[model samples]
Target: MQQTKEQYNTGTATAKQPSHEADQSKTQRLRDKKVGDLMVNKRRLVEVPYTATLAHTMNALVANKVLAVPVAAPPGQWIGAGGSMIVEADKQTGTVRKHYIGLATMLDILAHIAGTEDQLMDEGVNDGFDLDQKMSVPVSTIIGQCLEGLSLWTLNPNTSIVDCMEVFSKGIHRALVPVDSHMDNVAGVELVESASSYRMLTQMDVLKFLKEHASSGSELDGILSRTVSDLGVVTERVFAITDRTKVIDAIKCMRIALLNAVPIVRSSDADNEEDHKQLVNGFGREVIGTFSATDLRGCHFATLKTWLPMSALDYTETVFANPLLASIASNTAGPTSRELVVCQSDTPLGQVIDKVVTKQVHRVWVVDQQGLLKGLISLTDIIRVTRFAIVAEPNP
Candidate 1:
């Protein structure tokens, strides 16, 4: 039977399992589902052409409420001699390509805009470009000039759902599955052309699939038994900012780190009276709140325009001085600041998923017994495990 969103959310399709054996059988069925079954086919997918401007890309993402979109070669553009296809060629060169070259994400756009702000200030009026004109810069220029070194990860269509989950668990937001293609012999040279197929898999898709298939408690248990630490995918380095950090500086840190969100922490001395002079930071610091990409969405270009002229410290003071500005500051944590969704490093993966889905939040902080920050678990992280389970061979 086909699964529907309503059936999943309402748990109408999940049956009460009478025994552990029956629960295992149901989980096996879920593992058998293929990634192709859940993927959004290319024809129905939204994409941006290689030649689109940054403005056009931003409009598409905002209008669709999507975080990113696949960037494809212009229609009918052919690459390689005799129509042999190349995935991505330098945009400056008039080389035609047949496949998707990269992905343009909201984060990428934000970083580009942030980077441009520095250039505008450094060059002053001599830069010869005003605020409105800079905003109109072509996406091609930004991708080529600003993000020349980045690459997008691609996946195969036949990849098992379990394997896909592993990928998402790595904190990656999306993956592109290229259309099936074949090599053709033209005059003794191999040329490639599309079977005209592809799809995009995202965290949202994984969440939907989990909601549909793992609705029952027993079914959820089968998947959630695996601990997050067991995945061995936590980032090696954690970056955070103090609670008093300037909002603009925090944005710059995220842009540099290429992170959608960052943990907000505060440093304090340990309670041990004998070690009064010692300062405990890093994993020992307290996590006060979380600042995320969503917060930046509330900031207008006008806010950026007004704040660009000031120093970082001045920017912080100005934002704090005005209640209206404080509310819109990208790093202030705003209204929901105190309601951070957090878990321990040893917390079960299922609990994390439950909190994230039920709370409708993107990430959960991994804290220690003392409530000090340890790590993070985002939807992308949990989704990875689900994708991996679908692809992994079951034990005999």
Candidate 2:
């Protein structure tokens, strides 16, 4: 999935600038900041229990306006305790501990529902089941069916701002910093329990920190001079699906790739005579739009609940056929898809940051001159680069 150096060079490139001595002091100050200073406090953390239903989890996310929430194991449930659970315990105290099992993002839930519907549609012929029956299943079962071995990235409380930048530079959006836990009395026994606290550090937080703390005009110039291509956070392999592909399939692709959204392209032969035939047969691939977790909001679970009884093919076709579904799709020319912000590979780091903050978008797609998808630059990527600039080797 790696793009060649040639591919990178083809896009508009930003020129390097000479650093000025006046900016040295401001850069050093930013470098000295700790990630803990910017982290959201644990006590105010919004989380869901591991046992929560899919509907409940979705509601929680929608209510909180967050993309993901931590899934914590129920207290007293330890691995090998006649249930499949993972936890940490003190050997000497012989006490069970509660722990964060994983994170459930909006994408994860969408993927599970979409994938499960696809599977059910396939199996529905042999096993006759109504939509209500299928929809009533537990979220735990869907998670087990759709996602296994999901790993979460975490950060320590003392992590330096520079180090935090490194993680974001790798294209990760958020990291959880676990608050230290102490012994507590549970069931009349003093035992170490999973820390119920975590601080979520997001790219926005980091960016806001830099914006507020930047001391001089030259400091902003110094930070913005870095090129996006040089940051090393953009994904090498791009993941996209054709416009005619099922929305569920798009969700599955994003889930598998851990992407926030997958570009919706026209069929590969869209420009050829065969392209018309494919489009007639529902195979147009001109990068018509993008499907992201945010799109899920347009279709309420309550609506899905009502549509569950229809055959999978009928359900998918009818649901996606709606123009509302296309609202979030980012296309080059459509009125709705125009909302998708985009840039070239050679876009400057600062310009990307300005667009992100001003537009309030999570990411911007990198496209070639021909309008073909190249890579993606996210707020996390920009934050990572900014962090690096503040802490580069010659700190004053």
Candidate 3:
């Protein structure tokens, strides 16, 4: 398969900008820089041709973690008398054509082919639609219908990050193509991954980390009691035990109550003066097996002890005695893969997203130090919350 120009560059560079230049104030920097200053190098672009398949396009987008591509014209050829001349051949004879196409942006192509915003929401299949079927829409149709006159802006190799942000804040476009004739037919394309209009801060990343690592903090004082504890306005109820109790029973309770998650606590002991509950420095509290609606599609639940069969498998006695039955037996005999990832109730939200993103976890349980389940947060929840905040915030 032919690769897009974007796939060619590894993005590693030895040349470093001076420290003084890098530390300029945001306002001062933006005023001094141009698009060419902030623009990524030509080799950094993610390029695709107009004729590439939608499946190919989508895969490239996902692999590169980018949303756009640059389309370019075929390269010119060298003539005996002239340096490099456009190859022109007779159309009827299938001769080489000297003319090359200039660069185009991914947003333009997506706008045309991805269906209108309305069409995508109403019919184009963005919300859990079949990816294969959706890929059939032609790029030409999309570009022709939606993004008229969308052209790739060329940027000098030395663009500054601030200037790139300014271009994004203007809400004009999301990609820049670099022109380098020596490279090949189509030079390359760069994805403006972030729009300057959006506020991005280091604090956001910090908060996200804290949320996911909330489980690592010291548990609240005297928070390990079997009974629910109230901290002024807040209260935590202990509903399940993970030690003596099997995961089967815990899952059963989760289903019956229609609860998103349940808190697992150590059973109370009378002999000890320092209560196990009191020893609760927040640790060992895990969200374990969220039953939220979002998880229904991804979990392998048939092995749970609480899993009452909605129906039974019918098979010949010989078939049941065969190797397939052994496979089922092995699976049924093992432990459930469900695990709990709990965070302190006070941890910031962004921290949670970062931790979970790296761990391949679907949800994080928020809890008090006593190992009690407070509430559950999912990745989807964060995204939905963030998007809402952006949309609802008053314009400055």
Per-residue lDDT of 62-82 in model 2, one digit per residue for the tens? 666567776767555523111
lDDT of 3: 0.34
In terms of lDDT, model 2 sits at 0.54
Candidate 1 per-residue lDDT over residues 1-396, each given as its tens digit: 125533322233335555554445445455545565666432455777778877778777655555666666664552322233435333455344545555676666666655636554443333343555556776555552223113445555566666666766665566555444232121111123344444566766677567656645433555576667776534424677665554555556666666677776763444333221121234657777665655444334546566544433344333445554344432333334355688876666777766766655677778877878877776766775665554463544
lDDT per residue for candidate 3 within 1-396, as digits (tens), equals 112322222233212534343222211212233333222222354555556665565455544433344433344421111121222234456354332122222333333333324333323223333334545554433332223124333323344333333333332334432333221232223221111111111112222322322231112112211111121112243343333333323333343443333344444364354332122222334433332212221112222111211111111112224453344424333112243465666665445555555443445666767655665554434433433333344443
* Poorest 10 consecutive residues by lDDT, candidate 3: 308-317
Shift of residue 197 alpha carbon in model 2, Å: 2.7
Where in model 1 is the C-alpha error above 4 Å? Answer: 1-26, 40-43, 75-99, 116-129, 144-149, 153-156, 169-172, 178-198, 215-237, 267-282, 306-338, 358-362, 379-396
TM-score, prediction 3:
0.29
Candidate 1 lDDT score relative to the true structure = 0.55
lDDT of 3 at 285: 47
Score every model by TM-score: 0.66, 0.66, 0.29
Model 2 stretches astray by more than 4 angstroms = 1-28, 40-43, 79-98, 116-135, 142-149, 178-196, 211-220, 229-236, 268-286, 305-338, 379-384
Residue 159, candidate 3: Cα error in Å is 7.1
Q: Candidate 3's error at 135, in angstroms?
A: 2.7
